[model samples]
Target: MERDRISLTVPTHTDSPAQQVVQYAQNKDPPSRPLQNRLRKTLFIAMPPKKRQSDVVRRKSRQSDVQPGDPIPNRGKRRYRPGTVALREIRRYQNGTDLLLRRLPFSRLVREIAESVRPRGEAMRWQSQAIQALQEAAEAFLVHLFEDTNLCAIHAKRVTIMQKDIQLARRIRGVWGGLG
Candidate 1:
């Protein structure tokens, strides 16, 4: 009959602060299980009906069993020859071709020329054009990168805001209250 623990006939959203009294009364275990069991006994609940029902509905979601002695389908096709033995001729030809390419001096010259043109003062007209093209390509790449990053960050911020709003709504029972 105490005011804090009292219940009224009509619903008004206010919970009593008398829960601490129940908490202190329990020594090691809470009596919530007994209270819940009593509640379930008194309540006549109906489940929401499913739109469709089938014989295999409850059973089809599980993995099909494969017995130990059963011959696995496509087992022979799964076998792959070891690459070291199977690709021996191809590997020998690749090594020979790689050695031939290494013997050529023009590729190394192209690499050196590529490195030298990087300086603003040393860059020739063609070199500068190539560098400008590279710069343009890099700028385009960066613009897209930043745009995606900012978009993702903005989406994350919006999600955080929505979550805060939901939490705030829960705390105040649909009334506006600051996030807990």
Candidate 2:
């Protein structure tokens, strides 16, 4: 039988002549203050003094510059009678008020539903209010499902509802008749 031997190599560090020169350069002190003062005097010049504000001419304030307590000048006049201008204003107000309504409008709901389902395949078109009505219906369905699931869990003599309880609840409610 042959035995395998392993050899270890250790690294030895010795400072070269260039390293010694670098060490000596690092230890050397900076130049004396007299040389620094002479260099600054020769290389740098003093700047001219700035003029005082009182010596310069004062600028008069323009009409465009608004002062404190200045009443804002009205740019446009309001219409008193129901003219074309009044009708346009009324329409703008109605549109703004409609946007502030709590329920999502029919057109916006349809657009949102279309955007959500677009990635499934070719875009499916739906009528206005369809998505909003569908959402309300689904909410009601979930409420009923949760109630039925709670009852199922109670009937099974369990306080905590499990997946099996939900499955049994759905079976009792016949909600997934066509799902299979």
Candidate 3:
């Protein structure tokens, strides 16, 4: 197994103020060679291993008694908020056994569908279509399920100063003009 490795190293030469300004102007994106490399490696490891020419992950169906709409948890995050729940659901649809994958993001969902029925050509074709449908459903669920609600709700909270200024303003209809 490959171990995690990140080498944080400062540049050998320090840039003077003028050089720093020039470098900043010339390059809008800062260099993070080490960080980027680490990220790429991390993603590679995070995803399931690639087997043969194709990578497939299939979960056998449960007993006839198991109900739909329930999902196995594979959130990989703090599942305290709705956004986190949505994220976990997305991860499930993208990667595991869940009825919600019925909704999903198109391309990613399709790739997964391809993997599901890969062994049988005809079945694979149908699975592809199913995947597309599932992805759309999953994407929809992620978007609406996490928004305009408790978890991802963004309501503006105004700070009001309850000083005499507010009381006086309410009491007076008069403006800054000559007193009426």
lDDT of model 3, residue 148: 24
Candidate 3 accuracy as TM-score? 0.19
The digit string of per-residue lDDT tens for model 2 on 1-180 reads 233332222112324535533543477542334432322111122456566675354333454477879998988977566578767876886566233233556456657767886786576776547665665565556656766777888998986778887788787758553322
Clashes of each: 0, 0, 9
Point out the higher-scoring one by TM-score: 1 or 3.
1
Distance from true location, Cα of 40 in model 1, Å: 65
* Clashes by residue pair, model 3: 102-134, 103-134, 103-137, 103-138, 104-134, 104-135, 104-136, 104-137, 104-138
Off by more than 4 A, model 2:
1-122, 126-128, 175-180
Per-candidate TM-score against the hidden true structure: 0.20, 0.30, 0.19
In angstroms, give how far residue 31 of model 2 lies from its true place.
99
Q: Which predicted model would earn the best TM-score?
A: 2
In Å, residue 25's CA in model 2 sits off its true spot by 93
Tell me how candidate 2 scores on lDDT. Answer: 0.56
Q: Rate the local accuracy (lDDT) of all candidates.
A: 0.44, 0.56, 0.46
lDDT of 1 by residue, 76-127 (tens): 5555576765578767755662332232253445546766867755633445
Candidate 3 ranges beyond 4 A from true positions:
1-105, 113-123, 127-132, 148-180
